[model samples]
Target: MPTILDIFKDITKLQRCSGNHSEFIAYMQNLSQKLGYICLVDDVHNILCKKENSNAKIVFQSHYDIVCLKENCVPEIIEDEYSLSAKDSTLGADNGIGCSYMIALMYERFDGEFLFTSDEEIGLIGANGLNLPINANFMLNLDSEEEGEICIGCAGGVDIKAIFNNKKIVPNIDNLDLYEISISSLPGGHSGVDIDKNIPNAIKLLIQSIKGCDGKILDISGGERINSIPANAKAIIATKKQPKKLIDNMKIEKIDTKSEHLSIYDDTLLNYLYSFKNGVRELNKELNVVQDSINLALIKTNIDEIVIEFSARSMNNENLKNLKDSTKSDLEKIGCNVNTYGKYPAWNPDINSFTDTILNIYKNINSKASLRAIHAGLECAIFKEKFPNLKIASIGPTIKYPHSKKEIVYKDSINNVFEIVKIIAYNLK
Candidate 1:
């Protein structure tokens, strides 16, 4: 039998980024067959495996997809005494570690179902479109980042995109200088989990720096993933004079490049971006968690249009709806088209017998274990929606800086979590 670290190393070698998890799916299917477990795959490529003649029907769930920060990524493992990370890329330990836990359990012939979902990084796409026949009454979601905290609930989320048509114009002045303005080196983090930390968004900061500048926007682009706080942003502006206010961490360079067709937008766009409400909107004092929040996740200016993306989350469905409706109305007032998609319901906090069983097991191993309800979206919400009767609890190793290039997982935490999972599976009825 392979150890947890050995299985995790194998998982990192596969290309399992969002929308490109076919190879990983194949690998899981092959492994299930080799292990003599009955394997089943759904239309959305969610893999489910079960041992024959298993009386106890518990499901261990983990998504196979990860947020790929770099293109053509072959994850470079950087190991230390305590933890492991990747070189200039995300370690994919967000779900990889969870997948490894499930795989190791399968190798041990655990009497339960193993569920591998797809495209979880992109708003739980597989869970949203899941059509699998599930026989389990309880599910253990292995997607939470922090160890020793069993996640019983998570915030619901929706993707909001606003589009602005670019009004192209010919350059009227010949003496205009092309200056590249950039904001970099910001401590970007997970938009949902880190929104309340007051980290500055690079795109918002860049737009604020050039507020009253006498310049024409040539092009503006930044932000890689909608789920991450943008760390860098750059804009090419044709201006006769540089802006008065210079902010720190912003780089301004003068260039001699000239363009005949420059895309420009009115002050409405800037005002809209500035006026947008970001970060935590409300806190659930009762639950001690974030109740409502929004993230200005991405901004891109193309030849024809400027696209702005946001991720809005709320523990209450009405709050989530109101936030999205208000954002859409605000953008529509400014002549922008808005679209929202990838909406998933929230998983309400519940203290049931199943959760109590898992929590007790976790506490026996680590007496400091606690119950938590995260502000970020989790597939548990989707699972709850589909199987309202199914009891769900999420657990995982400590993963820091997920969805960014600095992601790392603690080796000790993985071993401890694996032990907890094994105990839960063995004692599960």
Candidate 2:
């Protein structure tokens, strides 16, 4: 009998961040038992709950994992008159609201299947490794952010990791002044959906700030996840000449160092990172979406090597492959070892009887509803390949600035979408 807000607030209390969702998985397992449903949990933590007595032929799908900007972050819910958000943290409403809607339908005893996926924020991990059988003929995904649009297709994606191992260790002591340059407080966002927003990447900005310093890099690290645009970066370097403050919004401080050995990398490292394309590459005029894009997501300095990660996406599978291959070749040309994985296929836009029915239902509640495809990756793309005959469509409430601390969801949109979903569950049954 709990309302969707009550359920969402309860969900925020749990620690369900991506790659750290054991607590949320346990909660779903326990909830399915309490609701007298058949719960099947896969190895990758994908949950499928089925209601046997009802004759509904549809399944509701949502990823249970969320993105965390900070380590061990569990956002505290903050609500106003119009929307629900978090206190300086991501609200997890992107898919948490979707999960809440599925739970509400379960409480109503809707005759349908509910699928909760894991590690979606990192990549479509659970959806790609989904081993559980889905007997439903239709799938309704509740992961789309906008309210009035129905998503019929989504872009494919791949994760690339590159490692540079040839750094020179210099034993010169008492040489040049050591300075630590850092960039912070930039507006970071979701790499996939927010690539076109023109938000400044902290790593790129930091590199540009120190590009002319001609400094020997000792240590450099930045970025939070492989799927997010970096908002903070720091580097310690040794320079002979004092560099003037070039860029705003960054700190340049001379620090006293006692270390005897410093690792110095070639200027090509900085040149490659600066020249790398980090945003939308092409536009799909017909779909009015980004045809190809790449995010230089994470960079880290290890004891012996430096590693960089990227998330590449495209609206077509062939374009995705081409992008991945070209990026790999580019990294290899720089004398770095490259690897690519976590690849998912693209979902081509299609409209069938099921989509028409869902579109009609949505248009009834809001006459402005329309069918569209997104540039970001969605689990529906994987489901479409897994079950060729199964019809799939995605819709959700209005969630703004997802995957960032500024994330918020409108209260009215949540309630309106719930009403439409309720009608779909009952009438389809």
Candidate 3:
């Protein structure tokens, strides 16, 4: 049987980004057949594999899709003394390692169901649309990043998009100089997990640098993924007077040609971006976790409209609703049309015999095991909503900087987590 690390290495070769998981699905189907396990794909392309007759009534769930940071990201493993990472691209260890654990457990003839979800990186789309027939009474979500901690609950999230229909006017080519202002090299990370880190957002920085500049916005675009803090942004503006001071990690280049169409509502757009509520709004003191937060994720300019996207998360549904409504009202006040979607409910913390069993197994392997709830969104939330009676807990190895190119998984942590998982699977009845 292949080890977890070996399986993870193989998974890195497949292209499993959101909305592009067919290749990975085919690979899993073929592997399942080769391993003599019954495999099926749901309507949303979630792969479910089952062993014949097993007393273990547990489901191991992990998403197969990853956030694509670069084009054709062929992950190159970088090994140091203690961890493994990729070269200039996201390693996809967020859930790839989880998938490997399930595969390894199945290969070892562990009697359990393995659910490989799709499009989880984008907004938990696969878990949201999951209609698979699950027979297990307990669920083990292997998507948590911290080691030695059992995640019992996670924040719910909603995606909000605001569209501004701005009037455009022609710019004079002779009077204005076209300059491209760009911000790069910001340490981008998972929006929910790293929102409180005070890491500068590239889009926000770019807009802030040219806030009061004498310029007309020609085109502006930034951010790659909705779940990731933007690391790079660029704006084309027609300005005669350059801004006095440039922000760090930002560059301004003067171009010879001028832009054809420019948005006349630059002040409104800048004001909105500057006044947007971002980062952690509230923290749960008892749980020591973020209770409410928002990420100004993306900005794009089209011919007639500008679109801005924000991700809002909270542990309480009422808090999430209030934040969403307030944000929508704020955007609408500025003459922007707003819409919110991809809303998933939070999984309230619950500790029972099932979680105690897993916690005991983890403690047996590592003496420092603890139970905690996370600020980030997890598929466990979706599972809880769909199967309210099912017991659920999430565990995984230590992964650093997930959803970014600097993502790495501790070498020893993978082994430790796998051992704990195997023990839980074998003992669960």
Q: Which ten residues in a row have the lowest lDDT in candidate 2?
A: 240-249
Ranking by TM-score: 2, 3, 1
Give the alpha-carbon lDDT of every model. Answer: 0.85, 0.88, 0.86
Candidate 2 whole-model C-alpha lDDT, 0 to 1: 0.88
Clashes of each: 0, 0, 0
TM-score of each: 0.95, 0.96, 0.95
Best by lDDT: 2
lDDT tens digits, residue span 1-429, model 3: 788888999988898778887788888888888887888888888999986554559999999988877765767888788989988888889899999999998788777889999999888889988987788999999999999999999998999999988655765654777788988767789998788888778888777766757666677889878888998888887777785446678888889765555545546777778777678999999999999999988888887888899999999889999999999999998889999988989889999999999888888878999999998999998898888899999999999888888788998999988888888888885
lDDT of model 3 at position 156: 89
- With a 3 Å backbone cut-off (N, CA, C), the pairs that clash in candidate 2 are none
The parts of candidate 2 lying over 4 Å away from their true place are: 171-174, 241-248, 258-261
Model 3 scores a TM of: 0.95
lDDT score, residue 121, model 1? 85
| Model 3: colliding residue pairs | none
Evaluated at residue 402, the lDDT of candidate 1 is 86
| Worst window of 10 by summed lDDT in candidate 1 | 166-175
